[model samples]
Target: MLKDVPRSTSFGHSSSVGTMELIRPRASKSNAIRIRRSGFQDFRRVGRRENDPRYYRFTLKRSGRIDISVQNREFGGFLGFPTPTLKVRLERSNGKVLNRRTVRGGEFGFISRRLDRNTTYYIRISSSGESVPYRLGLRTRGGAELFR
Candidate 1:
């Protein structure tokens, strides 16, 4: 019975011939860089020029309170030089300012705000003069996810 069974066969040969191009998504036009996680982010140098601000973007994984602290590095303290003041602002994605604080070098400027989950937020840091090194600390409460 097996020998007598009829078998089907294809008369044409198959070939996979085509051009493939991988297209990656373009980066956002805005200069803001995404913050992957919540914690201390140290900026070695910011605001190299006067009035220039560095912007960072982040999305909360859950609804909760966010506490932001910006501390300017005080390298001139021993020399008795005046501490630099850093202006930090928390804003919505659309550029609406939510909170602003001015912090001096060696001290932290803190901003506490309740934010919604899955919403985009921005942090703008500008130095009063020249360039300055700083540390940014992020804390979240009420089970809100920050960073990765």
Candidate 2:
């Protein structure tokens, strides 16, 4: 089953392509989403930029097996960027943190993290916190279809 998670959110200032975005459901128009789209700059990291698939997520209360994974891309070691920096976090309503992790640059890899099915969830990307131009997507558990 799929359902919108957050009540509402907003994006702040966007300084670069380092997009910052917040994920949630639109059904909760009763309330506005909260976000911080600020503090972005074109510092030009040493590693080169690579294209990666996006992720889409669904938040519903359930009790089944769940896993999170990420894939990193590399380009002939160009700009010495063999990996990409990432931040993954999970939270519940009332601002309770169930899990939080930082992915410090990598291409393709499994998150090896299992999520609790019977809980409210809100995922926030570390790179761009609900900012514009950022990308977020997910694949079905069977890996057959894509959703964003």
Q: Output the number of the TM-score-best candidate.
A: 1
TM per model?
A: 0.70, 0.38
List, residue by residue over 27-129, the lDDT tens digit for candidate 2: 2312322321111112112221211112223443433333444332222336874434555555565457656555544343333234444444454444322
Best by lDDT: 1
- Residue-level lDDT for 39 in candidate 2: 17
Give lDDT per model, in order.
0.75, 0.35
Predicted structure 1, TM vs. truth: 0.70
Task: Tell me the alpha-carbon RMSD of every candidate.
Answer: 19.4, 14.7
Clashes of each: 4, 26
Which pairs clash in the backbone of model 1? 36-147, 36-148, 37-147, 37-148
User: After superposition on all CA atoms, how large is the RMSD of candidate 2?
Assistant: 14.7
Worst 10 residues of 2 by lDDT: 36-45
